[model samples]
Target chain A: MSTVAGSHFWGPVFALWQRDMIRFLRQKNRIIGALGAPLVFWVLIGSGVGPGFRLPGWPADMTYLAYFFPGTVVLILLFTAVFSTISVIEDRREGFLQGVLVAPVAPEAIVLGKLLGGTTLAVGQALLFCLAAPLAGVPLDAAVLARLLPALFVVGFALTGLGFLVAWPLESTQVFPAIMNVLIMPLWLLSGALFPAAADSWMRYAVAVNPVAYGTAAVRRAFYGDGASMGLVPGYGPALAVSVVFAAVMFALSVWMVRRRRGTV
Target chain B: MTVYPVETDRLRRVFGARVALDDVSFAVREGEVFGLLGPNGGGKTTLFRILSTMLAPSGGAARICSHDVEREAPAVRSCLGVVFQSPSLDPHLTVAENLRYGGNLYGLRGAPLEARMRETAEALRVADRWSERVKTLSGGLQRRVEIAKSLLPRPRVLLMDEPSTGLDPVARVDLWSIIGQLRAESAMTVVLTTHLMDEAARCDRAAILHQGKLLACDTPEALCGMIGADVLTLTGREPDRLAGRVQAEFGWAASVHDGAVRVEVPRAHEQVARIVEAFPGEILAVTAGRPTLEDVFVRLTGERLGEPFFEKAGGRRKRR
Candidate 1:
């Protein structure tokens, strides 16, 4: 059977991916750290902005708490994604990844497995964050749940792939906090997660080029339903298309990095 | 089938201006316990990495079962099982879980994978520790589980990098006995790298590496036979001065090494008493014994195995 031979490729991918999942579940601090901080940020900053404050493109009735809800969800996903991918640096430093690198699996399978593992963690955290939507005055109905989950998954995959690329060449996790400060914080800030982008603001231009912007916009569209969006963000069709393309490209980049010259590692 | 389970043809690897492996070529016959013996930074790890398909050679090629390590990595990987110097098992995972994961990487699953895991665990004497997390196990026990995990795939060849590293003497003995038992039971072809002279002596055949070059490759006894009949070791604080005096006065070529003066002679027992009598208080202790693997390394490379080269600052100490 072709499947029998093909399992050589996918089998290792599944094993590596499953190993990450098991490690994530076993570590209690990871779960708390991944979910706890974003929840705190959402509550503190959301209420601090007050309900009456409105952006140029926000719906009149939407509170600052409601506006910050989807951004906090994206924050959870980013934290979990970074946390999961950081294990790659650990794997290399501790010699675990060398075992996988020597296996019969293709490099593409390795990249896909790690991306999926990180996506699984990110999406899990995102789901937990989603439960608090009502606190932000957003609905938790089936219609919202259905659209929000898929959009989060796509965003998770893209973000995790991006994280994998960043983490692959790094030999230590000590530099991650600095990297997160310089790269990750800016990515979320410009993605229209904290504030709505206006047509004339420079942020609108930055949002247009940011993949996370499309991801956050997709979630916002899902949260508000048809005709409820600020009209400042890209349409649902374009956001989803751009995000999927971003994910595919980031995945391909990760695969290339792994398959690069043998000496770099 | 290839005559050699492992073979390399002029394999070379370079890190910028430094060459890690330089024109190293050798072969390990099927079912043989082969050792790559070298000091730290002597290119054993580079060669191991190339054979295990982790690092591509900068020039020439290495093959496992006639498949090039670089061009046919998957095929080469399927035949080789590698146990690294550092711990590779996830500390959070149980022995059983680690074995299961290893089997899955080789495409084994379900009952067959479980059976192999149990078989290997029982053989390595880690079956009782299967449910314990790896972090809870001692270094020796973790290494046993690591060996068990690699065996789950039933690879034709096993390559271990510094297998006895960080093990107590008792644990080191236990590890070697396990390797002997595994080879006898399964006819496994085992290749291991080590810096310990005693460890290299246990191999059926061994290769000596120094500064990225192959010094010699032969059976342990054969390599030792390259040295003279006996080795006389003199331990003292001023070994370099003592060695120079021994060479100048006694006309014997003595070398200072590892805080000791070593001289290879035809009859060390006869020479040791004369040396002690001649030097008096200059020599702290003197011992004479048959030649071993370290003697062979010193004979070939003019330096003892595993000694730090830069620490030979005896010349400067005297001037000061």
Candidate 2:
């Protein structure tokens, strides 16, 4: 059964994670692409709609950029997570992943390695995007940063795990971008990242069920502070608990998916 | 206890309706360079995949160092190092980093892991290329790095699939020399598949497979001896006609292979002159030499190894 065998479990996991980081560092275009799209979205869409767009609970003083700010951070994390996890398909095709598969390491370690790798890249990019918060008119305090960092980690881990689950069984990368469009974009859109869920009464239920909604709310609460107590966004306590549970569930699902399709793929 | 590094009893693998491997049993000793000589689709890869724990057998048992390949795959994997026919290196990483990652999978770290990696790189003569990315290295150097990666774990049995494929003649020779050195120094048991007869001739023992069946298994000398003492090759413009004439005139059974008339004889040197004389100007060239592994393969399979079997099947399928 090779039940991880103590300290050895971390070796391959850490090595694989390190490989992903090295590859990410060498490819500057990937960093630019992952962070650029959401930045463009925050600017173009936030300006296109104009600052006059407002919800009932939002501060009358708020601008569209401030409302779209936290959503852009989540988008950065999601896009980076998706981009990094897609390498699982590439690695399998390139034959490097096969080398790892045939090794004595457990499949759980392989999944953990991939999850950690993708999550780290996503969180790093998300943090970098958060540096532009002052431009969006959101105050960047130490307490807010502390809360935002862990929220980003939980959100990034869950999204990366989701990407891992999708990429593990896939042999080719041709259709993955379509999945990103159909599944990921919709999940992000319905999470109340771009607008208030109360704008559409039925969407509140959808937001309640959407796992990404909790992540979006968690980030929004970190940014909005006392003003985030409105009904539109879930409270920080419930949001963090849900995001943590979602991350844990996705992690387990990623491990299960890898174990189910280990040698077959 | 001296356990056989590999043992399979009637190991069977079926890919849907196609039986890739049928009831085949074999055993490999602790230390010897064994060759699995077969044409493509002859089930050599299926067996190799099973032994490497990449594929499970449909029926029967396969063990490595007495560990069940299916039930105890981790134990089997721990002791088995595999060099796939296709390149398995990450072209993005340097040779040293690749080796370090491979070692990490086996719980190898710290100074001991670094020392072992250095030793393997030195042994394979790839120490100088350690800092170079695998994409920058030549095919031969990449192959040596692959071997070094496998050696990092100090496995008892090394399984390679068509290890010499895509290598030049010089690289092939270099690879065989390393295999020989590994055998002499560490007594490492090597099992590799090769369609090249010259490569098979270097093995301590070789198993010939045809149509998913074991045709013959023995040392190179013994296998050649099964056919005859010598082989007479007659090259002519009309090899089929020359083969017919030789059969009728000399009463020797001659076969046409690869556009050449071939005949097995006890004393080929004495018959070479007679064949040229009998055929006159029809024979462009005549050569008599000791039987090679190719001749032995031809004797068993009645077809050359590595040649496309599909072409032959295409013709048959049209007629049907």
Which ranges in model 1 have alpha carbons more than 4 Å from their true place?
A1-7, A55-58, A261-265, B235-251, B272-284, B310-320
Residue A73 CA displacement from its true place in model 2, Å: 1.1
Pairs that collide, model 2: none
Q: Each prediction's TM-score against the native?
A: 0.93, 0.94
User: Model 2: residues >4 Å from true position, as ranges?
Assistant: A1-7, A199-202, A225-227, B308-320
List per-prediction Cα lDDT, in the order shown: 0.85, 0.85
lDDT of 1: 0.85
Q: What is the C-alpha local distance difference test score of candidate 2?
A: 0.85
Lowest lDDT 10-residue stretch of candidate 2 chain B: B311-320
> What would the DockQ be for model 1?
0.54
Q: Give the top-scoring candidate (DockQ).
A: 1
Could you give candidate 1's per-residue lDDT for residues A52-168 as a string of tens digits?
696665578889889889888889988998889999988887677888877676777889889999999999889988888887788789988888878888899999988898898
Q: Total clashing residue pairs per candidate?
A: 0, 0
* Fnat of model 2, as a fraction: 0.47
